[model samples]
Target: MSQTTLRRKFAAGLTALATAAGLVVGAPALVGAQATEQGSSASLGSAGSAGSAGSGDAPNTAPAFQPAAGNENPVGFRNWLRPGCSWDPVASWVQLCDVWSPAMNRHIKVQVQPARFGGNAGLYLLDGLRARDDWNAWTRDAQAQRIFLQDNITLVMPVGGQVSFYTDWDRPINLGGNLVEYKYETFLTAELPGYLQQHFGVRTDNNAIAGLSMGGSAAATLAARHRDQFKQVSVFSGYMNPTAPGMYTMIPLAMFDQCKCDPFAMWGLPGSPRWGQNDPLLNADKLRDIPMYITAGSAIPGRYDQPSSLQAVFNTFNGIILEGLSRGSTIAFQNTLNARPNQATFDYRTTGIHGWGYWNDDLIAARSAQILPVMNAQAW
Candidate 1:
């Protein structure tokens, strides 16, 4: 990682969308491809239920709600894929969850769960900020989906929620040392690749990483930034533009606010001349070269008057969604996606909000051009 700042421009932080389970979708059919994995769960969960994407079960996550046993077309099927041993950590099966970017200072973390069935390559799954410690979702949903993977790829899930944007951070937070100062970028770009080759025997020709929400944004940004590293990248209803209008309302103002700095200071604010720098919107040209999977859901308004200790913030969230996220995130995502004028492989649709059910379900339906290549290359 280098201290050099990202000199590009970006919009406002895109508004976070409600999870897909709550949105309205007539139900889109699954894509043409079927990724092999042990458990079933092609499509399952509560319809029209509101929830947060990364905050709950997005990719590598289980349904917040389940159906009757007989109707377990999705849940039950995937459950079968779960290892019989209460040893549900997918990281244990084969390679399990392994932290990277430490030794060589690389910026990528890999979740390589040992496949009970044995495989190669890997599923580079990403997570939202809220999903840092939940191994169940990674073990079950990730491993289950691999039933389609014939063990040819590894499931690379990087832990370390808040700091990891899957990219090198220019500065350190609170007391942490600067990753760039420690050279994390070199590790993710160089050392980690060699580690995969040495440890997993992966060829690295086309290892893929697909993610939900913020993770999606990371996948796209990383692929675009380091094009040669990834053969493909996919994003599901991602909050693409960190600087989309009314988007950053949740960041330094809230989640990372106590840290004392933000992308604005890291780079520059809108109209500051450096705005839009490093933004996905500006890097669309770089992304146009890679196979991309992008999707979004129409977030709906929800109950706002509920009592809470942090009533003001809760009301803020309500106002943000109703007046901001309801429309702002979408505009940000679309604007960025549209940057690729001639997309050879891409997916951009809105059938629901940002929930696990629909996010997981969208994975089922958006596979025509998303992550199937990695799965297909190995076969479930």
Candidate 2:
């Protein structure tokens, strides 16, 4: 069939999918994306408020640092330390390493927790739309180091990539008086993985990837595109269909709100093949062999919500709408998977919103239920 015919069929299918998922078409979808970006900075601060035990309730009282065998530094892997990155240890297990990314032409900091008993499996955790340069939210918001301390697997979290969607863009972005290049797909799939294998004893192919919000979709995309490299994928509160009705516009608006970067530069114009190519729903067939853990909330306030405060109320409102949108897209993706022999686990929460607390819950659940087993890593 011709390209135009294929595009029309896809759009029609997307509209049907959205309607089936109970999503009001154009404007509401756009509003959800806008509100998500607007509230991300403030709402993100209330991470780990879920009131759940495993979901960030325990304190990070890991044992004192100890250097691995044959390594000199207190935290292990000193011998393999690259020049640009040094070991910045926070807890007994966590090490913040700054590694160079040639694609972006800058040094990127990665929060790492080496295996406690020396294992080869690794998990790459991704950040959200407003991802900061100094630290990955997985470390700042959630207690990843402590939670995974017993697991004989490395946790690799890369810092930064605000509004970049962790994808390789067609052009450079000028943000805050600096030109930033986003080749995150290249960095994560190729460059960073090489460094991890050499330095952290992680196999490039024996890995799992997880992310929340923007990073969630990115995790799925990266895993699908590089199936040989990533064995398992998990997405928490992610918009899986970028080419769905209103999402093509919604993604760019969110990008502009965060970095004033042009969305066109990231994936050409709306309806371009690149948009569909990057969409997880459109590429669902490619993931049939990969195990996936996908989740989203009802957008209702759960145990984590604090409605008394004004900022909290605003965040609650934004969280509801944002998660509702994420739910629509995620459910649509789930429906797509249902038709095929896809290996996916879907978690549709009865009460929750788009924030770190639920993502922490999802991550913990995924690790125990799917990730560890898929990568053949030991939980304890």
Estimated TM-score for each candidate: 0.60, 0.81
> Taking the candidates one at a time, how many backbone clashes does each contain?
68, 0
Pairs that collide in candidate 2 are: none
Query: What's the true lDDT of residue 22 in model 2?
Result: 60
Instruction: Highest TM-score: give the candidate number.
Output: 2
Q: Can you tell me which runs of candidate 1 are displaced by over 4 Å? A: 1-61, 64-94, 97-109, 114-120, 131-137, 140-151, 175-187, 248-250, 257-277, 301-341, 344-351, 366-369, 374-380
lDDT by residue for model 1 (278-320), tens:
4566667787666666665444422322223232223223322
How does candidate 1 fare on TM-score? 0.60
Best by lDDT: 2
- lDDT by candidate, in order shown: 0.43, 0.71
